[model samples]
Every structure is written in C-alpha cells, then in structure tokens.
Target: MIDEKEHGDVMEIDKELMTKIYDLRRRLHSIPEASMHEMQTKAVLMSFLRENTDLEIVDRGAWFYAVLKSSDDRIGDEERTPIAFRADMDAVCGQDGKPGHYCGHDGHSSILCGAAAWLSRASQNQIINRGVYFIFQPGEEIGAGARLCRDLIIEKNIGEIYGLHNIPGYPRNHVLTIDGTFACASTGLEIHMIGTASHAAYPEAGKNPGPALARLLLEIEELTEEYNRSRGFVRMTLIGMDIGNANYGVAASEGTLRMTVRAEREKVFAGYVDEIKQIAQNTADDGGFTLDIQEIERFPATENHAVNVDKLRKCAADQNIVVTELAEPMRWSEDFGYYLQETKGAFFGVGDGEDHAQLHTAGFEFPDEIIETAVKMFVGLALM
Candidate 1:
C-alpha cells in the first residue's frame, strides 16, 4: 500500500500536464491508422514521449516500448524484474470505409502516455522503486499486435503486465475486473467448398456444392449447441456466406462460409475449433467436394492472475476509484491474452460513461474524462 503522501502524489495531475495529455489524445484521435500499419501513429507517440520525458525509447518496427529505470541502486532480482503497462495504438475501419478511432484505442494510448509522464516525474523524485515499461502496440483490432509484441516480456524479464479497455455502458471512472478469463478466446473460421460446375439445364452433369454447404451449416449449428450444453459459454456467429456467381447457365460449384467462434476456456476453445474442422471435413467427404479451412484473427482467452487482480483492486481503492467486479467475462477477444500466457498480469476496464455509445459503432468516440482516472490506477499499480 502507498503511504498518504505517496497516494496524494500518485493521484495528483498537474493542470498543464493534463492539458498536454488531452491534446495528445486528440492528436492521436485525429490520425487513426489500421492495425500492423501504424507508422504515423507510432511517430506521434514517440514524439510525445521524447518531448515530455527523458526515457529510453526502443522502436520495435510495428510497436515500441519506453523504459524508465529506477533510481535505486539495489541489484536484487526483484528490482531487476520490471512491470509493464500497455496500450493499443491501432484504430478500426469506420462505416465510411476509412480507419477511425471507433474502439477507443486512441484514448487507451493516451492514458498510457499519461502514466508515462507521471512515472517519469515520480522516478525523478525517487518515489518509484522498480523499473517501468510503457508499451504502445499496434494491430489490436485484428488480433495481430500482441502476438508480434509479447516477446518483449520474455526478453526484458518483465514481472507483471497490465492493460485496460474503456467500457461504454458503465459509470465513468469505475474500475472493472474479473478473477479469470476477463475476455473470451475467439477465432475466425473460413471454410471453402469446391465442386465441379454443371450446366444449369442438366444439373446432374456435375457436382454442386449447395447440398454440402447446407449440410455443413446444420452440422455447425448442432456442434455449437452441443458445446454450449456441456462445455462453458460457446458462441458461433455466421458472419457471411457466398455461393458461386450470377451466371444463369452455370451451376454453382463453389461456396464459402465465414464465422467467428468463441469460448471461455482455452482448451475448450481449441476443442471446439477441432470439432468444427472435423465436421467440415466430413461434410466435404460425404459430398465429394474439396475442403479448405483457415483460421484467422485467433486470440486466446485473457485470463487474469489472481494476485494481479488483487493488486488492481487495491490500487483502485487507494485512488478512491469505484471497483466493480464483473459478473461474467466479456465475449469480445483481446490479443493481450498472449502476454498473460507468457507472464503473470491482469487486463481490466475503465468505464467511459453510463450512456456512452458502444465501441466500434459509427457514433462511438472515446471519452477524454477517464484519462486521469486510468493514469492514477496505473501509477498506483506501479507503486505497489
């Protein structure tokens, strides 16, 4: 626990600093970039850190991390192991067919930068005892960022990592957490069925994939029901389906089915995916159609370490922030799960507002008010 004076320092946000951070958030909000393609987004973050703080910034191609070493001279192992705070920098494509900050990533990045500014000042005053790293990642919208960046945790011997997302429906500034499986494990499954084309007049001349596709959909519906009954929460949504072209003379010989599968447990998630593949294979074999299956945007369940969750709760309490226990894990998936697999950590949520627009919608915009609240929690965790 932090002492009274330390708590005060941790929660204090200078007016000028707040203004700077807010401006930075707006700047990041203006130039939203796509996942894994955040060249311009990275430049803005790097420039902010370079201008405001004297930390070592390491550029890792698509992502980057900035480090503030402790002033303490202690050479112990615990001191060497650093804690990391992460923020995603990439944005999602809006309804306009252009990239925008629909998922509040711009605000998440700004909060991390605010924490960085605070940590730098605290380190100079010898308030921070251990090293801290600020990781700004890209490609989170498509589940590719954290996989490419999680290697840094192992390389630096990072002891604990934490990340947060803004929840739209909750009261603003409420800190939300769960003991395990904060977010569901999910992946996109694409199945392609190919058969010989036949003349429309004589459909029996060649094989059509329509029958196979219908069978596959039924089998998938059954599989989903079976899993949901025995296993934990399992959900499958049919995103799209397409059959062969508009040629009137030709029989449809090819079909594609795209879906997203999600489960609460990683093992169950894998089992569900395997069963799906087997079902697709069997349907293809029965209909004598060639089958092709691909999994995209794969994400493991974001399971939080109990100890880290406790730390987050305590930190929120210290900051006088409302701590809300989540009743169930979120259905959405986050690539931050990759980091938790390699190290002990927690991913949490900060409330945006009670009636704020939902994330990824056309009207969604990140609330700037929560930046101070999030930064204080991060600083408290660092002190702990």
Candidate 2:
C-alpha cells in the first residue's frame, strides 16, 4: 500500500495554474486523437505556448519540442548540454472502441505544459546552469513518434532526457523506477499457408493444411517454453488464427496465424522472430504448401541508464517524495525506448492510486490530482 502521509508535500499545486492545466487537459480529453493523427491536439498546445510562454518552438510534422535557454552568459563561452523532458500527446481507443484519454496522455501532456509555463515565468538569472527542452510527441501508441523525433534530439545535442507514466495500483504521488531494462521488446508476426482446395469427398485429391498448421502451432509453443527456460523471459501470444472458410464440404486451401512475440532483450526477440519464420517455412515445405510471414508492428526495449535512475531517486528523496525501485522491468513496450537508445536517460512511473482503474480500461481516467505531482517531478529533474 502507498504511504498517504508522504504525498502531502509533493501534491501542492498553485490554485490559479491548476485551473488552466485542468482546462487544457479536459479540452484535450474531449477531442481525443489517435496516434499519427494529433492535429487538433498539436494546435491547442501550440496556441497555449504562444499565448503563455516565451520559448522557441520547432515543429516536426505532428510533434514539436520547445527550447528554453538558460540566462547564464556562459552559453556562448562554453557549450552546456541541454536536458529534455518528453510527454506523449496522443490518445488511444478504450475497451469500448471509442477514442478517449483512457491512457492518461492528456494528463501527461498537461503536466509537461505546466512545467514549461513555470520555466517561462522564471527570471532569466534563475536558469543559470543548464538549458531545458519540453518535447510534445505524437503517435506513441503505434510506436513511431519517438523515432521521428530522433533527428531533433541529435541536432540539439541534448545530453540527457527524462520521461514518466502514471501507473495505477500504486500509492498516489509516489514515484517508481527501475535500473537496467525498463520494458521489453515486442512485435506482431503473421503467417499464411496456402495449399490446394479440393472437395471433402475426395480428400485424397486435395491438400488440407489443418494437420500442418496444428504441428506448427505446437512447435511455436515448444519454442516459447524453450526460450523461457533459456532466456528467463518470453511472452508469445497467438492472437489470431484462421484455417479456412465456413464451407462445410470443401477442403481447406488457405490458413493464417497471427501472434505477438516479446522478450526482455532485443536480440532474443529477434531470434524468436527468425525461429518462428524458419518453423513456418519448414512446416510449409514438408506439407507441400506455400508460406508467407509478415511483421505487423515492432517496438524495442526501453533501457534505463544506472546514473540517470540514481539521479531520479536523489531528486525524489530531496523533495520528500516517496520512491520505490521496481523489482522487474515492465513487460509492456513503449516508444520512448527509442529516445533512451540515443541519450542518457530514464523513464519512471508515478502512482495513480491503488483504487484507480487500470490503464487502457474503459473506465480508466487520469486523475487531475496527480498533475501537480508530475509537474513537481519534471521541475525537479530540470533543476537537478
């Protein structure tokens, strides 16, 4: 259970700014946009920055990052590394099949925006040591948005980055982080097998792929078990399968199998994909059938730098906020993995409370109270 007493200091929010942040979050929630299609959300954010902050904006298609330079005159005399904070701005469809802010991205975006507002209002002399960047990313659900921002990150010479997600079932306002791998690599695979269709009465004249497909499925299961035993992690799920149509009197000619492959390491995930393809080919060849394989989607594992993780812990402790080190990396995948690949950074989680609905659920809602907590964490990281 979360220690409620530890939340008091970290949950403080400026009443006036809280109103604006809430308004923005609700506005964003009302008009939810899917992954690559966040035009309206982008416009709202840009308008807010123009009206409220005096930072420079660099647009990159549906995403953008705002830069706030430090007041220190040493900027030109000596190069100082800029720190970046990223927030995803896209909403996703809920279990009810409707687009909404069930994933709490609306809240996440507002928290970052609040930090930007604070930085904008601070006096020039206050930002002396390091520059700051706030990145508003889109298409996180499809796992392409973070990769698109790679060029901007490289061009700006950002030395380190930080990210956050609100996780339910933990104590409200508490921060959780992990060392080393934070999330697993995942990808969807599709396999198609083709054979000759024939009348059911004359089964001998036509080739039915039922037996072959069954064997392939068993092989996949065995492979998953073997990988789990060897690598200590594997999640292979068969999400879809179709052997033939409803025609009762015809022998099956076409079959399809779809599955998701996940592993803690990128190499292990790649090996799983390759081995699955080989199994598909060998099975098809043995049964005199044609086989095809396709990858539906892919996301790399998110790894946290030990140094960054330690910094996060120190920052949290300094603010009197509770921190928990996770025992294992999350099995889910995140697009933010791409950012960590190029920069020294860490992605941590803030608790949304034990009673809150789980993420991606139809009833899940981003609690507005956590906005202040997230803003505090971002501000702390920026100044650290």
Candidate 3:
C-alpha cells in the first residue's frame, strides 16, 4: 500500500517544484547526450528514480525500467495491474556543434522524474487502481531504444501506459491535444550517390554523382506536394546535399542527400517510401549513379488508446486545460509509439508557451511555466 499522505503532504505543484523541474531541464540541456550514448542521462535518471520509488530499478544499457508494486506480489485482485509513465532521454545532434536540448527532451525527462517522485509518495488509500511503472527510456531520437524495454514490460505484466511530449506553439500552462492528431510514422533517410572516381580532365571516364543527387533533390518537392494532397499527413523533407569532394583535380565520385519522411498513417507512409525508391532508381538510371539508400532511424507512429484518450480528455476537462486540434498536422515523431504499440496507452502534448521557438531547433528552451502545469496534470492523472 502506498502512503497517500506522503504523496499529498508535500509539493502542491508550487514554486519549489517548478524551480526543481526548471533547474533539472537546464542541467540536462547543458549536457545533451545523443542517442545510445546517454550514459550520463541514464545515471542521473537512475539516481532520481532510486531516490523516489521503492520499485526495483533495472538499468539495461540505454533504458531503465522501474516497477512500483502494491501488496508485495499477492494473488487474486491484489495482483497489480501495472501502469507505466515514460519519458524519452536522448538529445539531438544540434547543428551548432554544441550539445542542444532543442527537442525539449530534457524537459520531458524532468517532468517524468517529478511525476515518479510524486506518485511514489502517494498513500495506500490513494492507490486507486494498480501498480505504477516509471520508464526512463533512452535513445528515443535514434528510434530503437524502446525496443530495449519491449520484453521487460511483458515480463513485468504492465497493463496500461501513457507518455508525454512537449509542443511549441501551445501556450505554456495549458495543454493541447486531439485524440488522433499526431502522426506515428517517421524516418530519417539518407541516400548516397556513388560513382567511379576519375580525374577531372577525363570527362568521359568519371560520372560526377553530384548531378544525379541534384536531380533527385529537385524531384522531391513534387513528391512532397503529392503526398500533401493525397495523404495529407505524409510529408517528406530533403535536408542535405553533401558534395564536398571539390578539387578541380578529381571528379566528385560520391554524393549524399539526407532526407526525412513523416506520416500519420503507416500504410500511407509505406507508399511514400515505395514511391521514393522508384524515384531514386529512375534518377540513378538516367545519371549513371548507384544509390545507397539507408534509413537512419524509424520512429513508428503513435495511436492513442481509446481508454487512455478518454481518461486524459476528462482529466484535462476537469482542469479546464486549453486544447487544440491540429489545423494541418505536424511532421515531428517520437519513439514513445513503441509502448503504445504493445499496450493500451497514449502519447500527448503539453504546451511550451506559444512564443517559444520550435523544438529541435537552436534557441528553444523548455518553458519554465509549463513545468507546474505538467506536474499538476500528472498528479491529477496519477491520483485519479
């Protein structure tokens, strides 16, 4: 049995908690670790989790799974139906060469840590339904980290789960989410144009791969527009055109283009990928270039659970939270979709203040005001 008084007795989502969350976010932001190299992040999260819950902490490389139990492994109705709250803990490889917290993942981590601490202190009478599992996930930006926790959830018998991510345009101290607004499918794509290297003087010998890459990039805009019209949620972006092998002496033998595609529906997204392949093949054929297309990461789309959606909707309603249904759609993606794939859960957005610059971009800071708003909402959801 949890100590409800212990949970309720402290922190009223006041200035103190806000300061803590803010400080945590900043500290994490300063030391942004990319993808699976989140050892520092894992250590900090484990320290926080251990200080908060009585649950066993299982640290497996890039992921940590903490299970909070009730009645100490009993039979019948006493058996805990585990619930999970997860937060992704990887940083973006910012363009500035400085580790950046532009993704607001740092904030997401602090909020989850805060929630775990608060819920762990809840009273026996406050143990409304079942067990609580705090999942501090690593390497979400790279797409496969959640796979690290796949077996652990099934083995631990976790029933339902939920996760939170921050949104840029939404007002701080408010919440914005529509049940089916977020796209669950996304991937970062890289296609390399490889050809024979030859001396610049021998124009007939070397196939400059740069021209093929140029053609490929030009065609992508049309493909993106088509996807916008047909799939609406499916979108593609070509990010890089790297042909730096410039020396009037040697013909460019290899070129590369970095791209990403995102979609609300998986099948539609698959169609886009197939279409992209066709485009690349045709482009390569004409330009005498060989293409090496490899996906950097695949982040599956998130489908909100019917039950969790209803629960959060009601909770937000009770709190008079501001809600926004997407006018168009967002191309951003999250790995939290992995948990939703396995269990009944939903990933949601909390406002980061309208003025805040977009996430994953330089100059974006996790808004200080949103900290309390997030903490309160988690408390409300947990206690309920």
Best by TM-score: 1
| Model 2 CA deviation exceeding 4 Å by range | 1-13, 73-79, 95-97
Model 3 poorest ten-residue lDDT run: 1-10
Selected candidate, larger TM-score, 2 vs 3 = 2
Clashes of each: 0, 0, 13
Q: CA lDDT of 67 in candidate 3?
A: 61
Residue 340 of model 1, lDDT score? 97
lDDT string, candidate 3, 284-354, tens digits: 88887888889878988776776787777766766666665555445677777777778777777887777
lDDT of each: 0.90, 0.84, 0.73
Which of the predicted structures, 1 or 2, would earn the higher TM-score when compared with the native? 1
Clashing pairs in 1: none
C-alpha displacement of 41 in model 3, angstroms? 2.9
| Model 2 per-residue lDDT tens digits across residues 19-42 | 898999998888899888999999
Candidate 3, residue 153: how far the Cα is off, in Å: 3.4
Pairs with backbone N, CA or C atoms under 3 Å apart (clashes), candidate 2: none
